[model samples]
Target chain A: ELKVEQNPLFLSMQEGKNYTIYCNYSTTSDRLYWYRQDPGKSLESLFVLLSNGAVKQEGRLMASLDTKARLSTLHITAAVHDLSATYFCAVSPALYSGGGADGLTFGKGTHLIIQP
Target chain B: DAGVTQSPTHLIKTRGQQVTLRCSPISGHKSVSWYQQVLGQGPQFIFQYYEKEERGRGNFPDRFSARQFPNYSSELNVNALLLGDSALYLCAAGRPQETQYFGPGTRLLVL
Candidate 1:
C-alpha cells in the first residue's frame, strides 16, 4: 500500500508570511504532483515533479521532489489571501510496463487560510 | 483546448439506488481516470482507463464499475449505493506519464 502523508494539515497564517508544506511517501516512486483546491471546487494542478531532484516553481509556489528519500515539498513565498486553499500531494506508483496509467494515491490535503 | 468535463454537476440518490456519472476527456487525451472525494479530504482514486481498457483500479468494492468508450469518454456506475458512497466524483484526463487535468466533480448526495 502506498501512503502519502502531508504535514500542517490545518494552517492559519497572515499574509506575506512564508511557509512550507512537506509530503512524505512510503514507497518508491518517481512521479509526484502538487495541487490546490478551493472550497467546493475542482483541483488545480500546481506542479508535477517527474524525477529525483526535480524542482518547479510558479509565481508564489515552488515544489521539489526527492525520490530516494521518497519526499516532496511545496513552499509558499510571501503568501497572499488568494493562495489560501487546500494543498495536496499525490504519488503514482511505478509500473513494470505502462507508466502513470495507474491512478494516483493522494495525501490528506493541507488546508491553508491566509488572513489579510 | 477544452479541459475534462463531467455531467449533471449535482446528483441526489437514496440508499440501495443506482447512479451513473459521465465524463468526457480533453481533446486528444486517450486516458481517463475517476476519483472520489469526500468533504475535507483529498480525492481517492477509483479507476483508470487507457485505450478503452482498464489499466488500473483502486481498493474500491465491486459495486463500483467504469468503462471507457471509443471516443475516450467514460462512465462510472455505482450499484447498491450506501450512505458512504456519497461524495464528489472527479474525472481526470491526460496522456500517459503526464499530469492529469481534473474536471469540476459531480457532487453526489445520498439520503
Candidate 2:
C-alpha cells in the first residue's frame, strides 16, 4: 500500500512569516497534488506536480516534487491570514494510464493557523 | 462551465438506515470520483467511475456501492449505515490525465 506522511500536523505562524510543509510518500509515483481545504468547504487544487524536480508556484505558495526520493514539499512564503487552512498532499500510485480513474492516497493534512 | 456538484448539502440518518448521495460532473467530463472525509482527517477515496463504468474502488465494505449514468451523473448508496459512516462525502470530476476538481460535498451524519 502507498502511504503519505506530512509533517507539522498543526502549525501556528504569524503573518509575514515563512514556513514549509513536507510530504513524504512510501512508494514511487509521478503524480503528486496539493490541495487546500477550509473548515467545511471543498478542496481547492493548489498544485499538481507530475515529474521529478517539477515545481509549481501560485502566489505565496510553491510546491515541488522529487519522485526519485518519493517526497514532495509545499513551501509558503510571507504567510497571510487568508492563507490559513488545512493543506493536504496526495499521491497516485503506479498503473496510471492517464484515465483519471486512479484514486489518490492523501496525508493527514497540515492544519495551518496564520495569526495576523 | 460549472464544477462538480453534489445534492443534499447535509443529511441526517439513524443507524441501519440507507442513504443515497448524488453527484453531477462538470459538463463534458466523463470521470467521476467519490471520497469520504471525516472530521479532523483527510479525505479517503471511495470509488471512481469513467464512461459510466466502474473504474476503481477503495477498501470499502460491500454495503457501499455506486454507479454512473449515461449523462455522467453518479450516485453513491450506503446501506446499513453506521456512526462511523458520518463524514463529508465529496465528488470530483475530471478528464483523462487532468486535475480533478472537488465539489462542495454532502455532509452525512449517521446517528
Candidate 3:
C-alpha cells in the first residue's frame, strides 16, 4: 500500500519560532505537493516538488523533497498566529496511463497552532 | 483567470437518496477530477475525466459515478447514498492530470 506519513500531527509554536514538518512516503514517486487548509476553507496550494533536492519557498514557509529517501519537509519560519492551519502532503506516481491514475495520495495532515 | 468553481456550497440529503454535484473547470483546463474529503482527513481521489472521457477511478463503489462534458465541466453522482457518504466533495482542474488546482469544496450532510 502506498502511504504518506507526516510527523508532529499537532504543532504548537510561539510567534517568530521556526519548525519543520516532515513527510515520509512508502514506495517511489516523482512528485510531491503541500497544501494548507484554513478553518472552513478549501486547500491552498503551497509547494510542488518535482525532483530530488527540490526546494521551494513562499512567504514564511519552505518545502524540500528528497526522493531517494522518500521524504519531504515543510519548514515554517517566523511563525505567526495567522499562520495557524492544517497542512498536508500528497504524492503521486511519475506517470499516468489509461485507467492508471497518478492520483495524489495524501498524508493525514498536521495541525499547527501558533501562539501570540 | 477564474479558478475551478463548484455549485451548491452546501447540501443536506436523507439516507438512500441520490445527489449530484457540479463543477466547472478553469478556463482552458482540459482535465477535471473529483475527490471526497471526510472531516479531518485529506481528499481522496474519486474520478478523473479528460476530454469528456473517463481516465481514472478510485477505490469507491459503483454507486459513485461521474462524467465530463465537452465544455470541461463535470458532475459527480452518488446513488443510494449512505450516512457515511457525508463529506466535502472537491473538484479540481488541470491541463493534463498531474498538477491539479482545486476549487472550494461542496459540503454534504446526510441526514
* Top lDDT model: 1
When 2 and 3 are scored with TM-score, the better candidate is 2
Instruction: Report the Cα lDDT for residue A106, model 3.
Output: 85
Q: Judged by TM-score, which candidate is best?
A: 1
Query: Each model's TM-score, in the order given?
Result: 0.97, 0.97, 0.96
User: Higher-lDDT candidate among 1 and 2?
Assistant: 1
Candidate 3: which docking quality band? medium
Docking class of 1: medium
Model 1 TM-score?
0.97
Evaluate model 2: give its TM-score: 0.97
Of the pair 1 and 2, which is ahead by TM-score?
1
Which residue pairs clash within candidate 2? none
What is the lDDT for B66 in model 2?
98
Off by over 4 Å in 1: A97-100
Interface RMSD of each: 1.2, 1.4, 1.6
For residues B1-111, could you state the per-residue lDDT of candidate 3 as single tens digits?
A: 899999989999999999999999999998898999999888898898888988888889999999999899999999998999999999988876356889999999999
Candidate 2 C-alpha lDDT tens digits along B1-110: 78889999999999999999999999999999999999999899999999988888888999999999999999999999999999999999988556888999999999
Q: Which scores better on DockQ, 2 or 3?
A: 2
Candidate 3 has which clashing residue pairs, if any? none
TM-score of chain A of 3: 0.94
> lDDT per model, in order?
0.93, 0.92, 0.90
